[model samples]
Target: MARIIGVDIPNDKRLEISLTYIFGVGRKTALDVCRDLNLDPGMKARDLNEIQVTEIANHLQKNYNVEGELRRTLAQAISRLRDIGCYRGLRHRRSLPVRGQRTRTNARSRKGPKKTVAGKKSVKK
Candidate 1:
């Protein structure tokens, strides 16, 4: 395992994919980091030398807000929205989809398990 930005990336994965183990870094950012640092994106993390790992760690510290920093800022933004009572904030508070997806059909992920409400017995014909 290679520890980068406090996250232990999988040793067998390519450097670019392994870099994505750090918070706030996606595939695009990982590729960009490799390009900027002149590191080989195709190399496996297990093959990284100590100096290369340290260089990557130092580079991330200097250039990016990741892990705890990113989480804190995002939490603060959500709290601000909640405090201001915005529609999106309310949606977040309610645990529903926040992107205006129609709740009438599919939002099972955010809406949770279906609650079975008993209906009135059918009237006699």
Candidate 2:
């Protein structure tokens, strides 16, 4: 396993994909980081030398807000939305999907299991 920017990256994955395990880095940002550090995107995380890993860490720390900082920023954004009583905040408060996903059908994963209704018995004639 390679530790980059205080996150543990899986050893089996390519450097580009492995870097995405870090909090603030996505696919595009991972590619950008690799490019900036002159690292091969196809290289495995475990194959990176200590110097390369150090360089990557330095680059991330200098140029990007990641890990705890990124998490705190996201939390603050969500809190602000909730405080302002926005529609998205209402969805969040109600525990529904916020991205305009159809709740009438495939949102069962978020909505949890359905309850079964009991039928009334008929008397014999």
Candidate 3:
């Protein structure tokens, strides 16, 4: 495993794919980084020399918000929204889907396990 930005990326995977193991780095961003650093995207992570690995780490740290920094920035943004009491924030606060997903059904992943309410029943003589 190659440690980059405090994350251990799989050595068996290609450089571009391995880079995605780091938070906030997607396929496109990984490709861009590889291009910018003049590293071969198809190269396996284990093939990276120590200097190349350090260069990648430095480049990412200097030019991008990633790992802990990216996580903190996102958390701050969400907290700010919650503090402002926006509709999205309210949804986030309530642990509901914030993207207009219907809570009537199929949001169980976000809404968690179902808490069934007793249904009314009537009997007539």
Q: Put down candidate 2 lDDT per residue, 1-125, tens digits, no spaces.
A: 87887788999999999999999899999999999988999999999999999998889888999998889998999888899999999887777888999987777777778756798989999
Query: Model 2: how far is 116 from its true place, Å?
Result: 5.0
Scored against the true structure, residue 83 in model 3 reaches a CA lDDT of 98
Shift of residue 47 alpha carbon in model 3, Å: 0.4
How well is each residue in 87-116 modelled by candidate 3, as lDDT tens digits? 999999999999998988799999999999
Tell me each candidate's TM-score: 0.92, 0.81, 0.94
Candidate 3: list runs displaced more than 4 Å: 123-125
Worst 10 residues of 1 by lDDT: 57-66
Error of 3 at 111 (Å): 0.7
Candidate lDDT (C-alpha), each = 0.91, 0.89, 0.94
The CA lDDT at 40 in model 3 is 94
Comparing 1 and 2 by lDDT, which wins?
Answer: 1
Q: Model 1 scores what on Cα lDDT?
A: 0.91
Candidate of highest TM-score? 3
